[model samples]
Target: MLHPALLDRLCKTYDGRKILDDISVSLAPGSINALLGPNGAGKTTLIGCLLGLLVPDSGAVRIWGENADKLSPETRCRIGFVPQTMTGLTWFRVQELKDYLSAFRNQPDGAEDRRWADWAALDPKARISTLSGGERQRLAIVLALRFSPDLIILDEPVASLDPMARHDFIALLSETVQRRETTALISSHIISDLERICDRFLVMKKGRLIGDLSAEVFAGEIRRLAIWPDTALGLEVLADLPDGSVWVRGWRPELDARNLPVLAGDMEAYFLALTR
Candidate 1:
């Protein structure tokens, strides 16, 4: 299991604008965590730090009980990473490429090797150059699974795949996560895909951690609340709610309020008051 603690990243522009300011988060073991953020939110930078591809200006990345920077080659070998960028040239053949990768990592011996190959349905000799984008993605995925790593990090792994391939990939990932007892951190802009397998999601905006919501919490806490402001002063009154869960949709008077569904009125009212 990989217990990750990202302390903070302080990135500053030449103009003195802070790009990433005091970001921090902890990732638990055996959990599927989705990092959701808009562009320029520093998701890529954070991933780079996790993968040891980039050093943070100011931060600590810890894995399990030790610092990530001090991880040994043996520890590093137990991690599988699939970057958003393509790994190799399209000219390479699939089977040939996978075989080359297999030689680098020590896969399980005996029947396990056959089982892993069969699991991905990858023929050892197929030309990667002939595969489609989805096929390439699948091949990359299988390559990542080759060593049975304890932790897998995927960045937009399904973006290039078709709907069916995407579905199959998620299913395969779900099965692997349970069977192998592996933890995963997948970053994707697709909300629906993240909603499917992610136990929790970390929301980021402008390089800041904006929200941390579990799937169940999101389903229960996020709601559409409608309100009609009686006066200009009414907006000010509603701004004092407790939970700070409100966002203004628009400014209008005499809202019909017919479309409003039955909700936890207390929470909705609380949100309205707080974010007002």
Candidate 2:
């Protein structure tokens, strides 16, 4: 079966610096995947290449087995994107903007459109320019999701939202994706929030894809061990640690025969270990 999205040996550079280097990954259908990395880790660059907004210097992007750069209107319509920042369209009122966008899809502004707007608690008469950051983000999400696209890509989507709004939005997204079996790709620094919905994790650093693993496997395999600071024995033990194991400064009474401590198996810790 074809993947919902695929990047094959994708690379991009800017101003003599490599922004994405030899990155390749596939997004499975009906799954919510999380992209995790610090600033300048090439997360946005990778998303741009995948969406065909920015051309890659090398490699290819394919969506549903078709070239991303040359997707048909029908194929394009099946993809929804919520960018990190909502810009432009500030001159239009909420309802007018919705009508304008709906016209492009040949869809009438009707009950469904109003339903989404109501869910977002967006006022029809309010101008976009006057909306708060969280409200603008909500508007963007409502627009992206109203069409019920087969695939959704969200970049830092919850960055501007408050705690309650963020929780509600995530819950809504989770329900929608599961009910429709839609594929989703979310990039965010909010690790705990992502952990609640994501089944897979992708880690990047210095424009390179450092780690990719299923949440189950990541929890089972990646581990944090505690070791004493003063002992040459601890240093010796560190040398024989399994590849990818991370050690911390502490002690555990329940060491295995090889002196390996029990696994901490934290998502944030795993991400930090890979990026570090």
| Per-candidate alpha-carbon RMSD to the true structure | 7.3, 5.0
Q: Give the residue spans of candidate 1 off by over 4 A.
A: 1-17, 89-92, 108-123, 228-276
Candidate 2 displacement at residue 273 in angstroms: 2.1
- Candidate 1 minimal-lDDT segment of 10 residues: 233-242
Q: Give residue 276's lDDT in candidate 1 (0 to 100).
A: 31
For residue 236, model 1's alpha carbon misses the true position, in angstroms, by 15
lDDT of 1 by residue, 1-276 (tens): 446434444442325655566777777767788887767777777777777776667777766655666777777878888777565666667666766676777754445455546655655567777776666777777777667778888988888877877776787777777777788889886767767788887766666776665766655544434343335523322232334333333323343353443234432243223323
**Candidates' C-alpha lDDT:** 0.64, 0.82
Candidate of highest TM-score: 2
